[model samples]
Target chain A: MTDSVFLDSIQPLFQDIHAHFTSQPDLNPQAAWDELVQSGFLRLLLPESAEGAGLSVAEALPVLMAAGYWALPLPYVETALLYAALPDALADAIDGNLALAVGTCGPGEPAQPLRLGLHCLDALVTAKDGGITVAPVSGDVEQGWRLQGEVTPLSQVLDIRLLGTAAECLQLAGAMQRVLELTVDYANTRQQFGRPIGKYQALQQQISVMTGHCHSAVMAAQLAAGGMQRSNTGLSLDHHRVAAACGMIKAACQPVVSTAHAVHGAIGVTEEYELHHYTRRLLAGRLAGGSESRWFEQVGQACLDSGASVFDFTLANLS
Target chain B: MIPWPQRQTLPASAEALRSEVRAFLVAHPPAAAADVRARSWMGFDAAFSQALGERGWVGLTLPTQYGGGGGSAFDRYVILEELLAAGAPVSAHWIADRQSAPLLLRFGSDSQRRELLPRICAGELYFCIGMSEPGAGSDLASVSTRAVPNDQGWLLNGSKLWTTNADRCHYMIALARTSGQHGDRQQGLSQLLVDLSLPGITIRPIRDLAGDAHFNEVFFDNVQLPHDALIGAEGDGWQQVTAELAFERSGPERILSAMALLECWCDWLRLCEADTGDQRTLGELVSRLAVLRSLSLSITAQLAQGQSPVIPAALVKDLGTTFEQDIPAMLADQIGRRGGEHGRVELMRTLAYTSIIAPTYSLRGGTREILRGLIARGMGLR
Candidate 1:
């Protein structure tokens, strides 16, 4: 049944995943990782030859988005996508969570934060010396690492980075959507001056703007996903996909977070409220795979170099 | 949840049709000057529209029986985006092709469809919407145009304000009060197919701030019409017009109104050695445009599926117009900051014209406030 099920049928499983995480908010990292492993989601992109589902990356996009929506703290994106990127023998050698860490830090600068730093991971994939390297991680061996892995070319690394960025875009989209819903629900129920605040024009206008941001973010993520599906290679990088991912991050990140919190007011920041989980992750997602501005510069510089009109450039690169 | 339809690309067939449109554009490029082309869809040329009709480009989504291409909505989207990007003059058949034919197809009597759809598809007959009036702008239901039933057929005895291209249009799809008094809001409203050449009807053009006379004030003083002029059913105008606005709102025209200006700006940028800041600005606009194009195309996909997604259409119009209006503001700031060194004749002219006309992006179709309110209502916030 898991071999080729439609997304419609898979939705209930996502809802169940959300429910499971919600019910056990304080669960340990090991237990949460175990739940994801039992869910059979990691086999989404594996081929049928390996006794796996053999689904394409396009088909597995919703799963990544659902993981983000639920704020599951495991390295689900890195592990799931790494399955297809790495050879079967190398992939099978890993037993626990696999986290992807980007950037090559110099001597003086502090290392960038690992997105899934708190998770129970078995290896770390890093971009160093213009190539991708994987290092095994053991208990409490967090800070530094010795050379103990094979390296892949920059092009292959870009493929991985693009896929990771697209995943981050979808994640940001899901989180922003949740944040918008939370704000809307809050506005409808929270009363101020004899009526729900949603009844006020000012609040309605602000929330309406927030709705545009959410919708655009979702559209951008879907664009990125479509771009991924259209590319010939498994984890290839396309300019359209990169631009769309950046667009999604730009639209979904700060604009959504600020508006959601502004609408929720003081309660939004408290640990008790559920809004912060999604909002905090939205900010992290914006910075994680690459900030919006970084990708925008690359895309922009290319457009300038092409010497084509914006419409012509966009039609050529994106369409 | 706001149901933004999933992103979709034009099918291979539609992409193939794109080359056809490009060839047509190459053969007959826009004859207007840079400043005039900056008007985009609002730039009217009857000969060009009729030429497109000859190629079956007009009314592409209509049936072949009515002289249309009988193509899918994607076909129309490809044609439209190409036209708007090249700043082609489409105003002559834009209304008739975009919404009028679709509205008539959905709600017109068989005779009405036979008579008007063919001519509209052929680009021989033009239409102007008569929904807005001097007394009614965003509040469309309050329109006071009355078409009283008379012995001949029905007598139209009111006026329409801001009626775009009314002076050139042969017909006006007037939303008049047929069965109820004013202040009844949406009740008893009816749509009538009014011939612009009828006796006692007069059309006078109104010049915009940019000195363009695209809009008109049309008056109907006891003008006679046939009994078959009523579109759809009586007292069903409210629901019918609501459906038509969905077509009017969700389109590439909303986003690409300033595209000509953007092209002009880019051409100038290519000549001069633009810095990283300028490139980044251009890239930001491109990213937004790419996403918006994706969103609009997705909505078009939904349209092809026979769904009238009014709420999503409204949301696109709101966001699209905001993007449209931003081009002029941002580019004008660049001109301002650069001052004398950045002076290029065509670019400056296009920029000035687009800046002058940008305000109407939100004002037309629907106001920003009204669209946001519609979105809020769709979100169940009202």
Candidate 2:
């Protein structure tokens, strides 16, 4: 059942959605949100009994590809994952009636903790320690409202709300792929010394390395996702596998994205151009998960536990 | 857009298989006395391999009619994981069971499969790759080996370098130029199954850094093969060899080479935690290892589904080799500088051995450059 939807419905939807976003210049989160809501993008993962598309993981990959391609900045993903557990009234608010924002509590807090006493809601925020919180809100006209904190850089904040750490990694990987493709295309089409720059072995080598990075990043994402999915399915996920994927992703994506920026040269970092958006996202995404150091520690422990052999560590975990 | 599950799911039977392999490893660890510095793929213990065969573990991926267990790819993957993780001496049967048998199953003539599959399944026959020559390591088309057609069969001439286990193998699948000129790198290249024990073939052992005779230089002078000894057909060697490499480059072996040493270091670290100051370094290593394993397992899953995933496979080999090589050096840095007792000093020595040998990790299957080229081509960069 899941396989069919993935091959038929979601795959096509993803391709179409990606093409739509790629061709469009002004990709606004607010506008994307409206289109997605109207198209039921937000409800694909939710159960059909709950008025959602009720797609499984395989079926929902297209949605991720769409989000990744457009670099869409909406909290659709966070909302979808957390929707079932949300309070009844909050859930109602999220049913296309109101826009919602959800954030995870920091570490050492209770599982699923919610921060209460926050403003910008129809009702006061309430929570059990670390539980997810949903607060309904109205426009600025509401009384007794006090701004508790300012969410700066609306664009960046929008990305955080949409992707979380894991999705952010995926987005960075996708962005890196896009950048490589663009750079290669540019190198081939741009003429230099009576031929395309790609004709030069030096430039080809650089592009080749960039391509390697992109490949590594994709593998890292796939592996990380595979581990997380295994955990969800009640299989013991090798912590080392997760850490290694995270480390590789961090290691590979940063350099690849930066090299791409370097390859694009002056024009890449300019504000007027769109390439900076991806570069910025890639930079920001790297920091979202524990930094390289943090992931490196995780990887080290896994290696040590498996007794320092890649074969042993992996085989033991798999077994 | 909704996030993909981002996790791999293995069959439940894998757990049972793991336990069985683990028990086997505990009961019969590979002979530690043997040169520990041999390349993991080239290092082998015939006794240990036979033990595995006795338990029906050899050729786990082959059909039961051919003395195999007729298991799924996951089962074979589990077996390999266990064998490699235990640092078991599987080198003796590694190529035969891992690539040769599988390749023959897919592409060899019926007689070839029937003749070799049982022995491979029983760990009685060993095979070596006669692909690389002195001049042609990654540029396979540069192979100078020549096979001349005769009425009876074909006569192969030339030498293969870096032929792992060639000295001890029963047979070799030699890739030689069958018809095309030296300029035609790809055309007329064909794979011929040659008996290593046949006259006119000589094997000279090559001692590696670890002081182990893991690889050999195999010289073939007018070595004759039966007409049916050819795998696939004339001028089909490039395709056959490429497919075979896809098998070789992909698999648990690519990622798990340093797993045993990593495990040993972990144990040592635990014993010396009090003196190590903080465990933060160990924690980081563990995380990195986890991601590598995850990436490898995901590739295994893809392979199980019959997807070649060539680029991803290359990525796994590259990243995996990098980590494998890094493990010994990183562990040495942590332990070598310290003033330690006799046992601790010996441990450091072992780690040092691995460190020196690790550099070849990327060079063996294909160099980092070759892998990157393949990856670029896969990504349409070429």
> Among the candidates, what TM-score does chain A have in each?
0.82, 0.68
* Candidate 2: residue A90 Cα off by (Å): 3.9
Q: Please provide, for model 1 over A155-248, each residue's C-alpha lDDT reduced to its tens digit, 9 standing for 90 to 100.
A: 3445445555666676677677678878999998999899998888888888888899888887776667656542223445576556755655
lDDT of all the models against the reference? Answer: 0.77, 0.63
Alpha-carbon lDDT of model 1:
0.77
**Candidate 1 residue lDDT tens string, B1-382:** 5674576888999888888999999988984567777776777888898999989999898988877889999989989998988889999999999989999999998888989998998888899999999999999999999988988889889899999999999989999999978989999999999989889998999999988899999999989988999999889999999889888888999889998888878778878777766766777788888888888888888889999888899999998999999999988887667767864888888988899888999998889999898888788896
- lDDT per residue for candidate 2 within B36-70, as digits (tens), equals 53345666677777888888889987888778888
| Model 2 stretches astray by more than 4 angstroms | A1-32, A56-61, A84-89, A92-163, A199-216, A219-248, A295-319, B1-8, B32-39, B274-285, B305-308, B336-343
Report, to 2 decimal places, the DockQ of model 2: 0.27
Candidate 1, residue B243: CA error in Å?
A: 0.3
Cα distance off (Å), candidate 1, residue B291 = 1.0
Off by over 4 Å in 1: A1-24, A92-118, A138-161, A229-234
Clashes of each: 0, 57
* Candidate 1 - chain A - TM: 0.82
Query: How does model 2 fare in lDDT?
Result: 0.63
